[model samples]
Target: MELDLLKEAFDRVAKKQKQSSSKTLDIVNQIEKEIEQAITKIQTTSNHTSVLTELKDKLNELAPMNQLDSNQKDINLALAKYTKLLEKCFQPDISRAYRNVDTDPHVLNEIISTHFYRQGLFDLGDCFTNEAREPNAASLKLPFVEMYQILESMRERDLEPALAWAAKNRGPLTQNGSTLELKLHQLQFVEILKKGNRDEALKYARTHLARFAATHKGSIQKLMACLLWAGRLDQSPYTEFTAQAQWEELAHELARQFCGLLGQSYESPLEVAISAGVQGLPTLLKLSTVMAGKKEEWQNMKQLPVALDLGREFQFHSVFVCPVLREPASEENPPMLLPCGHVLSKQSIVKLSKSSTRPFKCPYCPSEATISQCRQLHF
Candidate 1:
């Protein structure tokens, strides 16, 4: 909405300037005509003083110049209004301050430096850590460096490094139900077949792809079919195996697995958070405006009035909101399952429990249970 307003203001200012320019051009043309007439009259007349007097009288009319001046003043007024509007639009940024969440500065710095590390900005991360005296940053560099090396090799269609990394981290990958190892080996096999190395490709597939036969039978069968068109894999029925996009996908998959093994995100969390924050900012600003007089309510509210839908990429996990409290569960107020199998936040459980002494009645059912029976539930 603000952008639209800015665009409208710009257009208005542009139109006003255009009008002023047109008026100035008209005034100049009229003055030139009057000068030409005066020159003609002077060349044709014997009495130069009278001709000059008549030219002066015509010049003194000055209607066109006055109109141009009026137009210019209008333009100036429009510009001033636009400038004031812009100032008003930007004023909220100064007046409205977000309530700080009490996050530790050191932790935030570490997170920011790690974000740089995850993005392969080793030099920048190093500079930041060295300048900030972060000891932990020293250890953070090597792992991401190695991960990037493997990823870079994968991008170059050199799968050896990726295969090695995947093999070394096979246990964790399997635990995460990732098929990156098989996919890497499959990519390697496809490259061999594309190069017309049918014998080597079959041997490699038998040696590596056989292990995943039970889990990826269809994919394995499709890979095997590529052998029939060894010399012309591009024209094969399973031509996707030979496409460069496959290598790209494999590289991304390998990187995702690598990060997953380290208990990190495939995309940088900092980026995701920023994107979500940007998406939610307009809503927050509007809400702030609506609650301008109610500063205490704005500051004290625990939950947002509207949900920010940041799409699938930004959603990392499931969120549970307590029906009774109508507030989302957090670490401090985690979801708890009652003995009767109904769930509510821990704080809600306490409220419903109403003093730890007596048996608490379940809100959903007639079943009664002690506070101890309400176990914390993890999502």
Candidate 2:
């Protein structure tokens, strides 16, 4: 609803701007036409002073200044309304939401350097690390450099590099249930068929795509059917195969697999953190404002006063809600695994054990255990 209002306000401003510009242009054109007529009359009548006076009189009579002022007023009013609407919709002072926390400068620099490398900004990464005196922080650049090279080749519609890399990592890729190799082969087969080479496409499919038939029967069948429409896929039912998005998705998948193999996330860590922070900012800002009087409590808080819904993408790990306490575990009250395989928050276990001085039975089972026997579980 807010977005709709903003869009409507923007439209009003745009409409008013266009109307004002048109009116101003019309007034200027009229003045120009009158001046041209005066110049022509002067050229014919040899009465320069009279022609000048007439042009001035005509321009004043048209009331161009008043017309322009009226148009400007409409646009200004629209702009003012739009500005107020924007200010109401967005909070500009994000600093109120900020909390001071100690961060390792080296770790922060490394993340920034890695983010730049992950983004394929090798020169910028190098420059940053050099300036920061953290050359080792750019160590992650080599793998990303190679990944970018393969992606660059893929962007040019040349899949040889990517195919070779996929072939080299075929075992690991297959172990991970990745069909990147098969997808790459499918793209190659399509490229062959697109060149009006049916025999080559068929032979390529038989050699490259046949191996996946046992597990990917449907996909293999689809690729085999695509051979029937060689050279003119656009006219065939397989026209979607020729879309540019296929290559884009393939590139993304390849990058994901590459990052997975490197024990890294597909998204930059800094990017993910920043995105999640942006999503949670409004809530944090509101909380901060409401707790303005309780600044010390806010500063001492180990967890946010309220839950921030950062969506599924930001949920990197499973959250354990203690059955006994009925609250999610936190760093101060982490989930503990009992011998009976039942998990409960440390706080709940302590309470049940009477501060570890006694044994307590598992809430879900007949098994009992002391707090000393329980192990802290990390997500």
The candidate that achieves the highest TM-score relative to the unseen native structure: 2
Best by lDDT: 2
lDDT (tens digit, per residue) of candidate 1 on 199-302: 99999998999989998899998988888999798787888777778877777777787787788888888888788877767677777777886654575777
Q: Provide the global lDDT of candidate 2 against the true structure.
A: 0.90
Kindly report which residue stretches of model 1 are placed more than 4 angstroms away from their true locations once superposed: 8-95, 290-292, 295-297, 301-313, 330-343, 346-378
Model 2 residue 280 CA deviation in Å: 1.8
What is each predicted model's overall lDDT from 0 to 1? 0.83, 0.90
Q: Which ten residues in a row have the lowest lDDT in candidate 2?
A: 293-302
Error of 2 at 330 (Å): 8.9
Please give the lDDT score at residue 85 for candidate 1.
82
What TM-score would each prediction reach against the true structure? 0.70, 0.75
Span of 10 residues, lowest total lDDT, candidate 1? 91-100
